[model samples]
Target: MGEPKIRRLDGRFDDPEIETAFMRDSWAGIRVQAALTLIGFSLAWIVSTATDLMYMQDSPYFLPTLSARLLAGSVGLLGGAWVLMARPGSDSRDLPLIVYGWILMSTLTAVIVASVFPTAEATPDGVADVLVFTSSWMSLHVLAIGVALAAFPWGIAFMSIAYMITYLILAVVWNEQSEHPMIAQSVVVVACCFFAWLMAITFSMRARRRFYITRLYEQAKIAAEKAQEFSSFLLAATGHDIRQPIYALDLNASMLEELVDAEQWDKVKPLVQRQKLVASNVASMLSSVLELSYLDNAKRPVTPTTCDAGRLLRDSVSGLKDVALSRGMALHCEPCSARIQVDSGVAGHILSNLISNAITHSKGSRLLVGARRAGQFIDLVVADNGAGMGDRDLFLESRSALARINGGQPLRSGMGMEIMFRLAERGDLALRITSRPGHGVMACLRCPRV
Candidate 1:
């Protein structure tokens, strides 16, 4: 055998549907942020204004700068409300960037409000205390927003960096004459920002892991449902497979009784053969189902022992030779002497499945079973000279995907393909198929040689 070819990358990354899914996940976060920001802006402004009026009543700058403060709060309100109005399901990729814009606009409003009025010296106690209370309330707002932004880790990071920088700038440039402990404020603000970022990351990981697990559950549910459907299809399609054999057995039973009554010993030979053939058919169908259940349930498997690969193939082929001849086909095993480690019964089952599939579906006149040493492994090859599939996709999907029962190039026993796949996987064997439409198929099973 030659080396396998390297596969090229041809994945669908820029798919439009993928972008839509991304938007759906993000839309919830953006909507929540918008609603909260709008509410926060309204409450922050109303409280600050009412206090400024009561505390700074004597300050000359208070009355004149009141209008400028109102304008800043109004800007934040309008930005939040506007973002909230945009339909959440929209396919626009810039919605996240737009949310960032809202952040910038609010930050700008805060800066403008700061520059509008100077801290008055006359009512230092009243003015300073009111401002201090407002700043404390604002710190709590930052903490609340950090918790809300947990769904979007990147957004939390951006907000944390921006707010930390804003705090440092205000502490140095605006609090020069303030009697408050600016150093303590700076330290607390910086520490809180770091904590917020870590908290959001923890929340994001938990949320994403939960979503991934949910997806796996859905896929498993779908597989179980598909298996049920396949079972139903098996009953419908193989109705003849069961009926024909049973009908033959009934006829043979009647003939066997008459031959015995007449005491014709030689005449009963053909009737006995007919009874055995029909019984074998019934047994084969039931046995396939039983084998499938055994593999699926993860039953304990037998241990492998060193055996002659040549004899295994020869014995399996011999058993199927009569069936092949009945269908006007030929089966043979290539001479091999290489010893390999395998559970002989399981290996025989695998060989029987591959050979039976070839006889039934291969449309081939001849099939050759062979084995050879490849490096440290042994390759069990089943090659058929028959028209393969319309495409390799069907070949690759033989396990989960259904073959057309009546759509038919002899898709006999679903057990043949499905069982082979599961058994190969359980036994830790490497299975590969090589074929095209016009050409035949070669199922290569590779396992370690002892």
Candidate 2:
């Protein structure tokens, strides 16, 4: 046969590759968050440096000005650490609390540092210089606002409370003596309050968007699972209904052969033989269809028992000898004499599907089925020398062949494989498939040795 023209289903690729990509993307998001926090801190630091230079020589509040800058920078470092450690197994919930605590501490420290500095005279030229100088201290406030906006919107509520307490203390201590202190304190209070409100709004909008995305993802997942369940039900019903008639036909065909004689067999012998052949083919097709459907649904119950692994393998292969011969393929079973505790029906089903799959896909004359005791388990393998599947195809259908049940659908065409997978899962067996194009395929199913 020419090389099998392999094609994969749309948007369906290897699971491990997709998982790796998801982890990379998640790490990238965390890095972006850390970078944004750093940029906000940098801007605040630059403003503090300019303010410190303006009031350097004669300013009584020079020391306090330096203290505010140090506090803000420290808070920025803490925030960066929080983002860095926000990995899957790490404490994600505690991060927001840590950031909130840092912001609260920075705000209280800034308020104390600002109060220690004496108010300068409101000269025309000095007013502009003082405003520029004070703006550097405002960086701490900006950083606090940014933290509230970026992490969780509700976190601003805690920061706002901390800012209010700090503002009240400064209002009572610094503005009590000056006649115009109320005017100066009011300006600062209004500016901080407005910025906090704005940050709150921004946080709410972002939170809403995140909530919507999460809901949509959950809905999609539930829908996919439901669809899979429905497919399994359809396959089970089809198998049960279709197999009953086929079994009856096989029995009747066998009975008819026994009643006929050789003397008058010339006329009736050919018709009976033809009827039996037709019945057998019909039964084979129906059985395949049912097996495929059952496998696809994979809902069968498993009953594990202790049995001879070698004996089970022999019986399964004996049943497939005629099938292999008819397809011009050889079937051989070599079993290790060991007892295994497993779901016997599931083990049998798995072997059946592997053997049938090998015959269907192979152009080779021989197939091999065997098992060996490995540690506490028996490793069973079915190998075929036929037109083997490519890596991409093997990867796609190895876990669940339900995707290949329809020819037009570019998925496994039978329920038998799905049933086999479900059985393996229930039996706690390790099932693996390996295939190389033009070489052949090998399927391994491992179960605990009794």
Candidate 3:
């Protein structure tokens, strides 16, 4: 039976499900907003016209003539048309047009009301006229402000300041000598202040939501990348560590059978022992890889130990000697005595993988491992006189096995390299690779000497 596959969560913002949800929500919000705008405008128009008609004969409360009403209606309709028909996507430009249109309509309505209305009877008392004008103006301004705030709440403070200045100028500089100018001015001021406060609160909430969304996006991207890295690592580790030993065991078992057939009883015991050893090594390697993966994912605590780096590299080279010899390659370990503080087992694994990789890819029959000291750091280099990689091959990392190892093509090198890199990263070391076509490939692990 095949191993169960692990399914990862799709957290990308551009995922079909997420995109659909966002679009659905945005469209619903827009439709509702449009409907509300239309309703509000209709109500305002009906109320203003009805009130004017109801007090037609009273002082400062006369109905506008049909011609005047038609003119004002035409202007208001044109303004609404411009707002609704202009490019909706261009909010920055469209917002100004919307606001200006509302202001223009309100001003036109005020003018028509003033012209048709009769003069006040005594002391020019026209409180009703003043109230109608102020109320209409404030209502239109508030609508404009609300729309602006909804579109871009961050800019609400600036909009609030502008609205405040306009309101103050109109109430103070252009004050008509109505009986209740003070009351009209006070109402306008209070309405503008309330709207400004609402805008401030809305902007604050929007900023907080935006911050949280941005943080979530960044975290999701990082998690996706980490998951991809882990998946690649697991695939490579399975191919190299798990499969290789099984192959070795099968080869040794076949050899044992041939020895028994030839009546060479002496060789059977050693062959069986070697096969068992290979199986044990495979198990150990698998355990180590699993542990490393677990530690990386869980951010496990690590206890550092001091060990001899030179001895570790030498042992790693020794272990790969038989493998290299089988492929007609010589694995060489240059003399070095540099001692560094690190996990000996992890260091050995890194060196073993690097040397084995060099042997596998070598075309010239030799792989060299060497180390040198430079100030407070030690640089270990693994070089192979292989049909050396080009710049493209040397820099290639995180590619899949099937994509790389097809029909006798060279096995992918990045899995081992990534493991080496992760080890180096955990140990606060630096790993660098340099290669030239037809010359050789070299990898250096530079770690601080302690």
Candidate 4:
């Protein structure tokens, strides 16, 4: 078996489910972060403005449009808050575009409005005007792009390109009116724009790297803990379950030895048969354990072919009929005409566990196994008129967590359902359980119909 492929947040995953989940989560966080940062900064700006502590409040360029920028910022803040609940994770693509547009519109309008506003009793220093404009505009550019770094690197890349162009245009406009060292100052501004882009790229990737490593670490820790737990439970479980047949075998062996010593040959054949039954039961138990090991490591390769659904059902129940009858229960299967595409052994094993579980633990006279076609799929169900699981929701929550044997009252490994879960996961089969406490549990395995 190959190693499990790790899911990466920055790149594609081989598994469709993993890829979808990673993208959904990544975008969700990005949208929420972007929205909150915009709203939070707007709130901070309002508080500072009310206290008359704005850094560039006295600057000439900002003095002309401070009220206008504040109004725009407040409006944008309301829009951000509106989107906090209206947008879902799937709508993340449009979120960046909308946010970038809002920032661009507000900042550009403020700059354009301020650039035209004439200063009465004008000072003869043009470079001083450029310096004031640069001071205010550079801060706006930095703040706008700075809030976007939490979004994925892809969105940040697009934003950085657009913002760099916007900054360059602002630099060119201001350069026309500035006197000395204008070229050098423009170059520095562009360099700073580039630096902001590079910083966004660096920090975004770092955040993703941290999240990916953390995901792998958490998954590894959980898997290790579960493995340890299952191991400890299996050791004690095998001892208790295997002891019955082993004790029966010991008794039969002693009986056979006494019969042989007494020359009572008549009873030898019956005793041998009983010994075979006990041995066979032990062999079956061992086989189940081995199969679980294979499934755990995903070592078993599934090769599906066309097979009769009815024959599959019968084959699954055939081995368990004797055991079920011995427990005063009847095993019945309704024939299915639908043909299915599945590994017959795998499907049969899943059905066998479900039916055998019904037989061993359910308080009922009859166990019903059947299959039927439903559009492109066929559902194979095992149901009995017996006491069902106390917590049906928990049974469906996690098979590993519900490690109680046979879906019964005792605290034992829910080994059958756990095995069914592994097989269903490997086969891409849909398994569902429905039960009422006094009604019964219906375990359904849905396979693709051929």
* Alpha-carbon deviation at 278 in model 4, angstroms: 4.7
Please provide, for model 1 over 1-450, each residue's C-alpha lDDT reduced to its tens digit, 9 standing for 90 to 100.
Answer: 222221112111144554345346656765766556655755576557875586456776566445545654675566556667754455554445555554555444444444333354435454345345434543555566567655545555666676667666656655645556466666776777776777766655555445446656776898687567655544543452344345556666777899999999898997687567557646765564444444323363455789899988875565456556656788888999899987665666567667777877788798989987799999999988888744543354344443443364445433356556555665567677666775788887786798
CA lDDT of each prediction against the hidden true structure: 0.61, 0.56, 0.56, 0.62
Q: What is the TM-score of candidate 4? A: 0.62
Q: Which parts of model 4 are misplaced by more than 4 Å? A: 1-71, 81-98, 110-124, 128-140, 147-177, 236-244, 247-274, 277-281, 298-450
Evaluated against the true structure, the overall lDDT of model 3 is 0.56
Top model by lDDT, which number? Answer: 4
RMSD of 1: 11.0
Q: Which candidate do you rate higher for lDDT, 3 or 4?
A: 4
lDDT of 2 by residue, 1-450 (tens): 122221121111134443233334344453446435544653465456565667543676666666666666666675665466553322244454555565666565556545544355445344433333333444346546645344333445555555555555545554534343444544565466556655655554444345445556876788578558747744663453334234435544554565564445555665465455545545544554444344333354345789888877775565455556666888888857888888665576567666666765666788999987678878888888766664344533244444553443544433245555654664578887766677777778988878
Q: Give candidate 1's TM-score.
A: 0.50
Provide the clash count, candidate 4.
3
Clashing pairs in 4: 403-414, 404-412, 405-412
> What tens-digit string does per-residue lDDT give for candidate 3 at 207-267?
3345446657876799778768866875675575444355556667778889989999888
TM-score comparison, 2 vs 3, better candidate: 3
The alpha-carbon deviation from the true structure for residue 420 of candidate 3, after best TM-score superposition, in angstroms, is: 6.2
Residue 262's lDDT in candidate 1: 96
lDDT of 2 at 436: 67
In candidate 3 the C-alpha lDDT for residue 271 amounts to 72
Which one wins by TM-score: 2 or 4? 4
